[model samples]
Target chain A: MSASRHRLGRLIGNAVLLAAVATTLAPLLWMLVTSLRPKQDVFDGALPSALTFDNFSAVLHSVDIGRQLLNSVIFAGGVTLGQLAIGIPAAYAFSQSRGRWSRWAFAVLLLTMSVPFVVVYLPNYILLSEVGLLDSHAGMILPQVASAYGIFLLRQHFQAFPRAIVEAARIDGASEWMVLWRVVVPASRSAISALAIFVFISTWNEYVWPQLVAGAPGMQTLSVGVAAFASEEAGTQWGSIMAAATIACLPTVAAFLALRRQIFNVLLEGAVKG
Target chain B: MAPALLLFGAFVLWPIARTGWLSLHDWNLVSPDREFVGLDNYSELLGDPDFHRLLGRTLMYVAIGLVGGFLLPVGLAMLTLRHAGRATGVYQTLLFVPTVITTAVGALVWQFMYLPSGGPVNELLDTVGISPVNWLKDPSTALPAVGVVGAWQNLGFSYMIALAGLSAVSPTLLEAAELDGASGWQLLRHVVLPLLMPTLLFLATTAVLHALPNVFVAIEILTSGGPAGSSSNLLYDVYSNGLRFFRVGEASAEAVVLMALIGGAAVWQMRLIERGVTYER
Candidate 1:
């Protein structure tokens, strides 16, 4: 009787866990299902009777989706590249420096991370407008490239890096730049790559900055463009909106699937330590 | 270091300082002229009933987020600990799918789900012989509906953190507790929760802090804080007033208030950690 009770408990546990999974995925599943059916049949049921690529075609034809997607790539890619280019050296400096000064600097960086983007967005917008960068890709990418979070993450990895490797490279008369590139970077490739993937995915998912800055049709990122389309179409045209959402979601979701292990590792480390 | 500081100073430090200054003046975006308005905006905000309602709604969102985002995932993570196996990896991967997806796109999909007429959510409700409720259109439900989208997106992150914490709870301790005749539920409550307290505290603090900002995209896309600003939060107010309406000074004031509230939250979190709630063993 006790053994059966334990089995019953296991059954209930599996049931609850599966329900959580179903609840989490039901919306995405609905999105794909609705995108396949005809627009008029969206309300028919959960499952589509027949599938078609017509909605995808209609979404592609209706807007300059290609341009928006290209913009997203450039925006996310630029921010990622720019962040690594700047954040690596900054993290190295923080890691190598000694004294209360570095501690103070790190404290300031931590404080900056906690300041919500909404707090500074107004002044940043005004600054961008003053510089004639508003509604431009530069405007969206420039302010975001300096991420305290990235610098903080990289700094943690750099702090734990082996000091002997750096000293050996220094003894060989390597310049600071050379040491960074040839020694430190190659040694910490995994961490750096993890940061890159994260920065890229997050920048791709950014909405408010792109929506606020990219007023021009040509400069809007994929997420922003899809959002505009979704809000404009609202309750009517469910098929096209779902198709746009599916298209917008595909890149990051695909990336997550491919890089799940690395992503999970970074998230686990960051969560436990931070 | 120099380049990073330069960029941070330009974008973050300068902008924050500028926002503080801008809050003390009255300047519409189009106007070339600026008038000094010391504390008037603050006083007005304090007096305004709408602003109070926005703050209350913002707190409501935080409460919902605490339950849905933090507590639910943490509880689920603990449950999965009992059924740990190869399939745990699959559950982790699938649950985290929403975290990687675009919030704007996810909100759009939920917009479809919450449609009043024969939407999937309503269809499921109808199968149980219940009447349809207008999810997004009704003022009472709009804020919670938008808040849930943020909670959903946040689930994977919180779940991963909780799972890591649970796994860190030493197996030897569990075995010892079981040897002491503790039942499964007793072991969970007496052994695991205390060991997991630090992680739980961190998750709680982040849930409160992230609630407002996380919901901003949903509010913008799903409802635009609609049905007469019923769903608007503090961040959305800052966006609409500053960017949309171009009331730069007033918006900056709102922004300043938001920063103070966030700063206060962080300080409280630090105090909570310093109070020694973490279990040594």
Candidate 2:
């Protein structure tokens, strides 16, 4: 009887976890379902009476979603590239060096990380406009690339780099840059790729900054484009709006699924700091 | 280092200093009209009834978010901790799915779901023999409705954090407790919950810090803090003040208040992590 009770408890436990999973994914699943239903029948019910992919075509064909998707790719890629170029080196300096200036730089990164973006939003806008970058992709991507948290996270990863290998490379007459390129970067591929995916997903999904900086739909990223699609559709055009949203969401979801372990690692690492 | 610092100054530090400077002056973003107000903006803000309401509402959001972030994750962690084996990884990946999707997109999807006219959420209510409620319309339910979206999106990340914390507990210790005749309640209270404290505190503090800025996207898409500004939080209100209404000085002052508030929370959270990590070690 006691053994049966334990089995019963285990049964109940799995059931509850499954329920949690179902609840968590229910809205996202609904978003996917809405995206595929015929436009006219989108309001019919939760389950599609009939399914069609016309909504996808409508979003891609009628709207500037295609351009925006490309723009998102470019935007995310550009920021990722920009950040890795700047942040990796900074992480190297911070992790390997015992210099006062390197310590000061890390402190600066941490300080800037603490200052939430809203406090500086207006001033950044004014500065961007002063620099003649308003309504441009540069305005949207540039501010994000200088991520203080990125430096901090990479520093964590860099500190875990085996110091002996670096010491060997340096003793063999390798320059600092040469050591970084040949030893550190190659060794830290997993962490760097994970960081790249993190940056890409974040910069791709950034709505508020892009909405503020990229004025017109023509210049907007996929996130802003779909948001605009939703407002224009309201409740009337759920199909196309869902399609746009699904398009905006696809890359990140796909990335998460593909690189589950790595992305999950970053999530836990960057959990509280974000 | 030079390049990152230069951009950091241009984007983060200089702008923060400018926000401070802007808070003291009565000037729009670009208008030639300007005046030095000398703490007038802040004094006026302190006396403002709407600001008070906004603060109260903001705290309400934080509380609701904490309930979702804290209880839901703890519940999930407790359920799956023992049952965790082969099936555990799959369930975890499923739950962590939401944290990856663009929140802007997530917010819009919620907008469609919370539709007043024949939305899926109301239809589900109908199936339960309850009448449809305007999830995003009624002032009484509006904030909670938006807050639910915040909760749903947050549950996954919080669950992950709790899981991370739960994993930190040694299996030997739990098995030892079980061998000591601990089951269910005693096992949890005596062995599990105490070990989870640091992580829970970290989650709670971060939840409070995340309340404002993160919810801005959801609120913007879902309600625009509308139906009488019932759902508006501090971040959204400040954004509207500065961006939409051109009340630069008042908005900057509001921004400063929020900055100090979040800055305090972030510092507290960092300290918590620092202490918690060492304590765990």
Best by lDDT: 1
- Shift of residue B102 alpha carbon in model 1, Å: 0.8
- Cα lDDT of candidate 1 equals 0.85
Every prediction: chain A TM-score: 0.96, 0.91
Off by over 4 Å in 1: A1-3, B171-191, B268-281
Highest-DockQ candidate: 1
Q: What share of the true interface contacts does each candidate keep?
A: 0.73, 0.71
Identify the candidate with maximal TM-score.
Answer: 1
Candidate 1 chain B: 10-residue stretch with minimal lDDT: B272-281
**Local accuracy by lDDT, each model:** 0.85, 0.81
What are the runs in model 2 whose C-alpha is more than 4 Å off? Answer: A99-101, A272-274, B175-191, B276-281
Q: Looking at candidate 2, what is the lDDT of residue A253? A: 88
- Number of clashing residue pairs in every model? 0, 0
How far off is residue A55 in model 2, in Å? Answer: 2.4
